[model samples]
Target: MDISQESGLVWTEVDLSGVFDLDVDESLELESVGDGRVLAVSASPDVVNNVLVTDNGVDWAALPIPNGFSPWSVDITGERWLILGRDPTKEAPGTQILFSDDRGSNWTELAVELGPFDGTAWIGNAIVAGRLIVAAVQSDTWQPQLDEALDDDMAYEPSEKHVHLFLSDGGPAELVAEFQGWYTGGHGASDGFHLIISGPAAEDYLLHSPDGRQWSSTIVDVHVTDSARNELWTADPTDGRFKLERFEGVFGSDQVLTLPDGIGWMPDLAVGPAGVAAVGGPASPNDELGGDFTLPDISIEKNGYELRYNQPEGGITLWDLNEDSAVYVFDAETLQSEGEFQGVSEVEDASGSNVVFHDPETGAELVAFSGEELAAAVTEEVSAAYSEYDPDEFIIGWSTDGTDWEWQTPQEAFGLPESTPDDNSFTQVQVAVGHDFVIAMVQTYEFLGSDFGEDAPIGVGDSQSDSTSAYLTTTTSPSPPRWFVARVE
Candidate 1:
């Protein structure tokens, strides 16, 4: 499970069995707790149905679930833990909101229900500017044949979408603001909550919530596809056509697009310090959106994928499942296609002498410019590539030109031993590096055998599920992990 990429630096895995109770099989989702400690939320059972709370990633504690209904998600704010879920019984109309104090030792349930729309409720919460704001879709919108409800665009309110907001409190999550149509994505920034919602269905829109209670909407906004440098990006979706716009503190600016025109079915958009690129769309589209500035066209499967901007150089790269695990790279400024790079390790910077990417299926490491062309390389169905338990080894490499990489292993680069990693246990590592501190989250699957998810259900109510076995199952995807924080010089 090791990625051939070598980060020559030393990384130590601190034991957080104390915080996580040694449950390696749980799908741990990590969030920084303003304080020195980290806030971890994990499943109460083998599946991602229940949730547990941990402060230090060493010792853990359980939260109170009122109706025995598993929580859908928990919102971690500067001061509170808001666990949100739906009551699975007929008595409660489906919605449940619980508020917890600092250590999650106690919880209070509020009367939050969707009334008539119980079956169609999809709720979420995010900490915005030190406040807790909750968003819910009250429409049972869906397509009968669709595997995922989120993709059912026809199910959404064509004329308008309703987005409800709730403020953080002790007794109940107060419903504050309600807007039209459904909110697609929401991100909390310091100014407020930046939300991308469908306006009049398919038209573009942006929402700004100064506080959890108030929301303002802007129409014909930029269709932001990715976030970089504290700002969001999207090809201009105005005039019901394509153009590129960078969303700053506000919307509405001159189109930054310099790509060709008449591209059709453009699903994904990406931008970097260098330039912008659009993928997928009509082969010959009317130049209604492409004005004078021609933004180059970067082609890939026009559906179900997005472009990732390589930082430091602003090059664009994406994995094309249709292309048989092949990764295509395009220059940022010129938008010309670079050859496919497959199965190396970490993404190298523009200046690195060695560039590395990995084979999506085999987890095989391929060095850049090693004369290995993996365009449509055969291995396995690209869909089944990596999972939560499948961990890859990461390394740092140097390349004189970021495009071609002559990767260096830790032993070769820093003179470390061949076996210098923290352990043989395979799990994902999410590291947050600061000026002097680093929080490395070491994920493992050892907890599947542990009794972590086999315990009694958390809720107590007449509406709770009677079958305790319903509460436990095999661990879910993206198995959770314990957090280990250290300082780096």
Candidate 2:
């Protein structure tokens, strides 16, 4: 179903292939940097030139990266942009921090010093707090010793790991404190007031600091998922069912929410001004089969080959991997379940993966693939497998509230030709939300295999690929993905 023509929702497509190389880059990270602007960085480990900034998400320009530095993460607060990377060419080969005052037009690397320890160090987390830049640095030292067990052979083992918390104010970073433990890097979050760094010992072991200098250590049982303002959202799995808990602070007035049945463990949770939302698929008891959702009995026949798509008595549909996965919305203050919507699965690490974005003027907005209607045409006939389905029909779904949703085909939304001139098909999609707009990244794929001919007989199978093996071998080259900006009024 599509929204009314007068709904005042418009989508514009923006080609990013010229500036960003989506073919070589595995994933893209996007963050809203306020003022209707968004910062995107390509997560290619081997490439250094992969940064872009867009003011409207429709026109994009490349942001230059410093030479000899491979950045892994980018953070921005206000006008300050912090880039954390490693410069292996340095003599000590440790973590390097780059600061930009004018939105990345010029950069300056902060002189970070790791005393005495001669080894490699990398930045696990970095944030811009007001005018001070805080970073968590982990260093690993190699210790070599002669082993007597194997004829005095030389053996090397990593020495004790050290975590250093550094604070800088437009100058060289000062080492504030250091700890000795095995730090699990890449686990951290900031709530605009406090910084929380996880790991170095147990998963629950955390280091908290208000100004990046004085820190306190604590161990919490709940897994912290997101933080907004002064509150934090955690997933509590002590009982048999899934529970979502919100804490006023680390230990303050808290509210516990028992999620509905069929939701998977530790579903993605997000907190915003509008409310809290959790999304995940149903829990699969076994490894080889799907979750506890039943699928419809559908079949199609052509050329002596019966294309039957059936689910085991109590399994999900073969076409929709996220049939039962849903988005559950709740009140921001009372933690009451407002409503729920189905067919939205969670994509890990994407900007707006399983979260709901709150716009003060227009309420909440969410963008995701229409799992049920995505490949509906494939169930009609065997020849339909090779035919070009409408790329713009029923591909993406948008929602203002959790209950009411609007659907649009990619062709209609992006103003593409009714028929793709290159025979490219939509494969994956991800979206990021801003205050006034939503940015969508759609990946297209081209079938490379010649097995799906007009006269070929396609057989039914137990798995999704088994029923249609010809769709497995597809390529993204020649036709790259696309980016779209949607404005809702």
Candidate 3:
């Protein structure tokens, strides 16, 4: 549970859902469509740039253009066709959207545009209503960039907030809505006419229109901005108490539940087919009484698992996802079995949460509800020597001596490897270390010979074959690692 940044990237799933073969380095993108088949997109499943898709977890076809950086966020139209794109990335500039009429056999360029998106941009929760595509975009101004250069003593620049709205009116990329403030977040729509926003701030500036030209607004409140979307639960930051509130026909007239004062609130709250669940810290005598400790809280309403909570007086609290109902719940602080339970899991005493679930077939997913830090990594090494044949294995390991080894994956290790291929030898390799794991990358040597000759000919061999040294193209020196693991449990 005390995973290093290197260990965090090595994610696993039970079923491929469709095409099951491929090296683990093949980065995958997943979209859960409820009863509908989950969508999995992979760029470089064999090599970066190449795109592949699987439906019903079966047949995988390639995309005409190789999938580029962040080419995985897809919006499925009511029709079978889906809207795919080159999601914004710090490494890769610009943003683009592609339309796939056929499952994924072919695609048409919908639109492309320059993006000011960065680590703070919220593009993941994009929603589609009628013919419009709504993306939670960040402020598009030089102020943010300039802010970094300004002296700390200088006053902070005003924050520019807006939602980039694209409509099918003509082509993709067509600017529709340009509201203000950082992308808070919201979800609700009907026809092209829809009501959407996030965070309590988004509620104030309302934009409802069937066409791009029109917009509107409503009241706003305290913003609930949580990076862990799944753990989108809230509690009073001041007293650490909880109260479940249901958004009634009227905003302030919410149905509030004062929890049994003594229990703490978990960072995550999940609601799905199964039921609603929320987690929090330990319980205290005050938890039963409730007050500020109960002010800001999360409420979930699911079919199977319904739960409400208040910070507890003692012990780690828990919850879980119901596979049958598809509701996601954080694993109990202490593992649970079918039956009545009491007390709580030892929060601080616990090393980390280690509860994960997945479809039985693919084994591609290994979701851990609460565990050590889940680190985001950068590609460390890469090679493009054999574009036709991707190396079957790229192992990451650790050693006190730096020479010994323990095989691991880029997702599992701190620094990951990124490669590019030249005519024969790989042109470049880069390694990136994330929060929880360390990583290393190795590329396969070029087998082709220089003079267009076959094999090594005789002794010294040709230039191409000579270039193929049976050793690592690059090795990284160990250094102080970088990891910031948030304690949500």
lDDT of each: 0.41, 0.47, 0.34
Could you give candidate 1's per-residue lDDT for residues 1-489 as a string of tens digits?
Answer: 232332323444566554455354444444433223333444334433244444433444555555345565555434555666655554744545666665456766655546645235555443434435455544544435444454636253223336666665344567776766656656454556666666555665777766656777777445433311112333335553232222232121113332222222222222221122222222222134332223323322324333344421446565555554435565555444455433434454554444454456776543342112222221222223323222123332221111222233323433434442443222333333222333445433322344445343321011111222143335322245544443334
The clash tally of candidate 3 reads: 106
lDDT of 3 at 123: 43
TM-score of structure candidate 1: 0.43
lDDT of 2 at 39: 61
Q: How high is the lDDT of residue 244 in model 1?
A: 28
Comparison by TM-score, 1 against 2, better one: 2
lDDT of 3 by residue, 1-489 (tens): 011322212322223323434453343333332222233445432444344433322334544553443454554423334453454443554445555556556766554343555334434334455445554455443354464566666655555545566556325555566655545444323323333355234453434565545666554343233311111222222222222111111011011122212223322222211112222123332234332232113322233332323223221222333643322233444223555333222233366554333433554332333333311110111112123323222333222111122333433333434443333332111221221222122222343443334342111111111222222122211222222111111
- Worst 10-residue lDDT window for candidate 1 reads 458-467
| TM-score of structure candidate 2 | 0.50
> Distance from true position, residue 205, model 2, in Å?
3.7
Model 3: worst 10 consecutive residues (lDDT sum)? 246-255
